[model samples]
Target: MLQRPPAEPGMREDEVDTPALILDLDAFEVNLDAMAARLAPTGAKLRAHAKTHKSPVIAGLQRRRGAVGQCVQKVGEAEILAWGGVDDILVSNEVVSPLKLRRLAALNALARVQVCCDAPEAVPLLEEAAAAAGHRLGVLVEIDVGAGRCGVAPGPEAVALAERIAASPHLRFGGLQAYHGGAQHRRRPEERRAAIGGAAEAVRRTLEQLRQRGLDCPIVGGAGTGTFELELETGLWTEIQAGSYVFMDADYGRNEEAPGFRQSLFVLSQVMSAPRGTGRAVLDAGHKALPTDSGLPLVWGRPGLRYVGATDEHGALAVEDAAVPALGEKMRLVPGHCDPTVDRYDWYVGVRGGRVECLWPVAARGAMA
Candidate 1:
């Protein structure tokens, strides 16, 4: 088990409480710039997913970097970002509840709001809500681009959904939401490319069918950090929805090399207990502090150390040598998954040049409705 770090008088980086959520500002901005540069010539605008950072400050930075808009997973997230002054937002997931749909519809009174629909049953509810709110909502038909999650079948079904959305007085059929979320972590570059290729083909067929029906799709949005290049090259995706590029995590680092960006987000943890043991040490960050669904955290700057295990509030590290640091030492931990790990914290402890720079709030952290 790991012990908590001792409190100090002032806010030194080392003296800050253990298991704090840390954002490496320099690295983060570099990642941001790299993504913007890559998308500059492609003509594919970025709809950076706010589900990853959930920070208005980060969203503003992305907006400044040429991102056309931000994509979020829920109405609460849309509300937060819209209130935070984001001009464009897409509720990338489907909104079903009447109350949630009302909230989503209400956003149109302020900013551009797009939402997804994967089922026929959802359309009437959304139409009713939009009509009730007296707002025009942009609707995207979510296609199951191999994620097997929340999307309708890719071809004719998608066309039919689009037709329904287009016919609605209060809603406009925007385009298709064809995202292969599982492909982002497929490890092999070729595998990811192939997965996206199939997804692109599915989108292509869907678009053809829609056009055959005299329907035009203004947007076909999809792609994530790990396999965005493939989607960008496909010419099918008009917009790429990548959020993790701003804060790459351990799992993304495990992706095939030659990636356009680098890891930037980390959890700053303290060595609270330096108990004597070979190949075993403990840290103050655990499951609650750092998500491990993708895998355990990788100890940044420590080549031989491994964050092998964890509990609710403790992380055990497997030290490869006897020269491990003593108690009160601070270390940076690369999170396994940036999105969920970020959702766990309210504040992002921005650090630069080994010093605390600023604290940015996770404005939409728990916007899961």
Candidate 2:
């Protein structure tokens, strides 16, 4: 069930209900423009990962700014984006279930949809579903470019999978999915460079192998916000899937030389308790409202304040100064991880100049199939 919206237009920011998902519209627009401008010179297009924003409203905004389309992780998310009028989308992960493949194939009537496959056996299952739907499904061979996750090994292994996808009567072999997910959070610039360097080499060798097999690889899609520049330098990755650049989190911000993006997403929590002289305060938002996987949320713009810990319903704030936040004082928290933190919200309370401007539904939130 959808909960009541936390705030309405014309309301002051402080008037919003506690524990709301807040978006700084000014910063968000800047981030959007900055990302487009940065990628424009590289000749690579943006296929902004919708797995982070999960909203077609944001996707539309991104498209207006030159994004080719959106990238998602699940069939359900693709369904949401397609139903919401996003014409092009890529399920940038492997899908195996027969029922899910059928659903994916059915979406061809509404949008141009693509999915990744790492195994040759999965190709026929996908072929059968696409044939039943009477459409050719676009398939990318995901190469394990150091992120030992759901991708086939580079070179011969990846070429073999691509050959299977190309031979399928109902599948169109789209290029490689060589995203280095683990490298996106490497704290040092050199570390990220090395990681992406290895990934690029693997992609290079795989492309060569695909060519030698008489196969044409059209798109080399990969790269997140952290290492997009490096991938761009390699002149290999054609589609940049940098999602968190629009709403940077504490985890991304921790990088020594992080990408030039502002912190646009926040969890708005109100102070519910402040024991006298305890140097601590309690916030209404906690584990249930914010993600802690990357680490605790940062107290936005509060230099001396720290989010020490969180329970299910409360967050412990460590007050560095003697001035503890008064009761009902509103605080904005920059989430540790933007992706999962975004999944916890139902609506994005877009604020501009400290006033509520708009509310956009998290259309694909929890769309985990």
lDDT of 1 by residue, 165-264 (tens): 9999998999999999999999888999889999989999999999999998999999998888999998889999999888888888888763667777
lDDT of predicted model 1: 0.87
**Model 2 local distance difference test score:** 0.93
The TM-scores of all predictions, comma-separated, are 0.95, 0.99
**Which prediction has the highest TM-score against the true structure?**
2
Runs in model 2 lying further than 4 Å from the true structure: none
lDDT of each: 0.87, 0.93
What lDDT score is found at residue 123 in candidate 1?
A: 89
The residue pairs in collision within model 2 are none
Off by over 4 Å in 1: 1-12, 277-279
